[model samples]
Target: MTLLGDAAHPMVPRFGQGAGQAIEDGFALAVLLEHAKRDKIPARLKAYQELRLERTSRV
Candidate 1:
């Protein structure tokens, strides 16, 4: 399984991004998985990772 938010990118709590990032992760993952078939789950998850990685890194 893949990880999200702090589980994927742990960071200091001073900026308070933990919960926000987790919510963002959940929404993004949900969108990617919404229409995915069993055979497409891997691709959807990878897409979610790529998108979130870029986004969270920049935040």
Candidate 2:
């Protein structure tokens, strides 16, 4: 249901961040999903997007 890294924000290979961002996404997802409640999934994903979107946009 949630996309990460290239799936969320594809970039040129010149950036050299596809893999790194994917790892970061995975890490963040793990933390956000830990003991997450069904009702809170949306908020958790929103938090993930907020955390990553800004950084990826700058990159």
Candidate 3:
């Protein structure tokens, strides 16, 4: 399973990025999954992680 939002990148409540990041993560993952082949789900999930890790870490 994959984590998103606060579960993925918990931050100080003052920063207020938890919901937005989660939404963004969900949207991005959804997009990736939508275009991925049935047998490529794992690859797509990895791609999702790679795609979000850098950005999330920065936040």
Best by lDDT: 2
RMSD of each: 1.0, 1.2, 1.2
Supply the global lDDT for candidate 1: 0.88
Error of 2 at 17 (Å): 1.0
lDDT of 3 by residue, 24-54 (tens): 9999999999967789999998999999999
Candidate 2 residue lDDT tens string, 1-59: 79998999998897578888899899999999899999999999999999998888977
lDDT of 1 by residue, 1-59 (tens): 78988999887786778778988999999998997899999999999988998888977
Ranking by lDDT: 2, 3, 1
Instruction: Give the whole-model CA lDDT for all candidates, comma-separated.
Output: 0.88, 0.90, 0.89
Per-residue lDDT value at 23 in model 3: 86
TM-scores for every candidate against the unseen true structure: 0.90, 0.88, 0.87
Off by over 4 Å in 3: none
Per-residue error for 4 in candidate 3, Å, reads 0.8
